[model samples]
Target: MKNIIEELFYGNIDTQARGFKKDSYLQKQIMIMSNSEEILTERLKGDDKKTFLSFVNASGIVLGESELDSFIVGFRLGARFIYDTFVDNITPYDDFLKEVNNEG
Candidate 1:
């Protein structure tokens, strides 16, 4: 099984919702959290935005939350089975490691 962090940037980590902009910190957090099933979101049900996506990656049921609920963070991609190129061993983790500006 490939690492979840690798999958995400490799386009493996899919989400039903993507309106949320991809943040470096958020990506790292998601990658680490991928080890488990549950994920706490930074977005909310309705604050001052339009209809949002119900899920993200691997379609899962949301438990619900005031700030952000457990969003889907995984899904089986058809490309991996159908195409060899899709199943890239050189995952996003490699890229992340290279350009990781660890300055906060």
Candidate 2:
């Protein structure tokens, strides 16, 4: 098998291009959100509409950042699990904290 790092470096791994199955819960919710946005946008006008849109865009940015943070945390946790499995067992919180602090 080809190396994952090589594939990622060559732009072959597009993690951002995720998809949801048709008629799935996520798809249904996305449809509902889109419909709601269209309906609300039609009702809003002038400054109110612009303000609402700006708010929506800002909220989306915040949510995206939060999701990225969560993904990073989960990835780190998975790596930590693998480390614990194969490496020397260092399960104590104080020991972990000391090692982390020493790294910095």
Clashes of 2: 0
Instruction: State the lDDT of candidate 1 residue by residue for 11-36, as single tens digits.
Output: 86656456535777878777676634
Model 1 worst lDDT run, 10 consecutive residues: 66-75
Candidate 2 least-lDDT 10 residues: 88-97
Q: What TM-score quantifies how close candidate 2 is to the native fold? A: 0.76
Query: Model 2: per-residue lDDT, tens digit, 24-56?
Result: 999999999999989989999999999989988
Using lDDT, give the best candidate's number. 2
Q: Give candidate 2 regions above 4 Å deviation.
A: 90-104
Top candidate when judged by TM-score against the true structure: 2
Looking at model 2, residue 44 earns an lDDT score of: 100
lDDT of 2 at 10: 93
